[model samples]
Target: MSLFWSIYVGVLVTSNLGLAIFLYIYGTRVKIPIEGDGTTGHSWDNGHLRESVRRLPRWWAMMSLTSIVVAIGYLILFPGFGNYKGLLGWTSEQQVSEARVANAQKLDQMFARYRQYPVNQLAGDSTARQYGNRLFQDNCAACHGTRAEGGHGFPALTVNGDDGDFVVSTALAGRTGVMPPWGAVLGEQGVTDVANYVLSLSGAPHDAARAQAGEPRFKETCAACHGAEGKGTKALGAPDLTDHSWIYGGDLASVEQSIRDGRTGHMPAWKDRLGEDQLRLIAAWLRYNALTEREASIAAPVADARR
Candidate 1:
């Protein structure tokens, strides 16, 4: 606090303490004249009651003294006395720093062990998976879902995190999936036709006539990039439209909008944001989660025998 404010607070506290102490002592000892009826000259409740004055109880006086002593001691020993640090020399910042050091020390050993394993092997470990889950929940949960299902603009992390294709790209910094809005090039009608064609690539319900009409334009323009199957070139960070799984949305209207105005979403580059240790752990976690989902496909007897 400023000097003036500190002086003001000191004055107020002094005045309050002085008044309370005086009242406590004087109120108990002061004499009050009483009627012979053994009551003060006060009546209430239709004369059925009369006020009686009593000295403060010995226990109450002791309690009050104890509280005052504690307050004074606290003011002398703590920061309450106008920015005066306590004799104990404790501070919140110091406490937080100490806690962080302790936490880091504990994690140091874990990191050492983690660094020994390859990213692929680490993904299979139960302990690493647990730690990775917690780390992901803390850092990645905001953009990705709690379960990593994803939303309108966010990529589905359930598949992305675990799969080799996505994990490799996502790690060593992150990836930006940008489909620049093609609206200006296509105009309104051309945008709609191309969107239908994109949907047809996935076997999604679309207007065949419009998609056919868009084929020439698509081959000349979009095919150079989106590919003949619309399977998107990962080399360009282009999404596989044929999966019917959209980074934005899968509906006809949303698909049309993506082609019309395009979409740009950024998943932050993690190179500088996180330490190398964290990056490796996160990559392992992603692979672990994605591998589990592929079990059904690989569970077949014929597939197992081949493996």
Candidate 2:
């Protein structure tokens, strides 16, 4: 508080306490002349009432004295007095700092153990998995969904799955997948043909000759980033076209539009937002989920494929 406010507060507090003390003391000892009728001479209500003079009740006096002493003790021990900062010298900043230290110490112990395991190995750990799950839910769930299954414009993590290096590389730094719009360059027919070709590469249904026709154009324009086979360059974060996974959509029209115009999906860097330790834990869980699901996919080839 400024000197003026501090002094103002001090004066008010002092006056309040002083008044209470004076009243307590005076109430007990003030004397009044009493008549034989056991009443003070003061009368009211047209003489129907006469005031009775008596000692302050012992209980009330004791309570008031206790309250005064407690208030004074509080002012001395804590921060009630203006600008004094109290005898304890406590501050909210100091308390928070102390709490942060304790919290860091606890987390450091858990993180130390986590560090021993690679992101892959940590996926198997129950404690790490539990922590990783919680961490992912808090940070990644908004975009990736509660189950990490992903949504429109976001890559499906569980579907066909990408390899560890691909996933980790994207997670660590983050990546923006850009398929620049080719609509203006390729006429409507060319866009449809190229989309069929991309679909054909993954063994999805397409007019084979049309797909073959589209290849020359695809090689001329798309091969550099998407690669000769359309499996995509992981280094470039060009998605594997051979995979069934699709970011925009896997349908025929969706693929055509993608080929004609293109699309971009941006995953922001979580490192600073979530902190290193937390991001690492979430990364661990994603790594775990990816590996387990990929294995299961291979083991159970789509039933239709078996035929």
Q: Pick the candidate with the highest lDDT.
A: 2
Give the Cα RMSD of candidate 2. 5.3
Tens-digit lDDT string for candidate 2 (1-307): 8998888888888999999889988888888779988897789999899998677789998998999999998888777667878889887889999999999899998798877666667667778878978987887788878777777788777642324444555666788878888878878877877888999998898988888888988888889999999878766667778877777788889898888877888878765666667666776777778777778767777765888
* Residue 307 miss distance in model 1 (angstroms): 28
Where does model 1 exceed 4 Å of error? Answer: 35-38, 41-50, 109-112, 125-127, 164-174, 183-193, 209-220, 223-228, 233-235, 270-285, 293-307
How accurate locally is residue 60 in candidate 2, as Cα lDDT from 0 to 100? Answer: 90
lDDT of 1 by residue, 89-111 (tens): 77788999999999988878779
Overall lDDT per candidate, in order of appearance = 0.76, 0.79
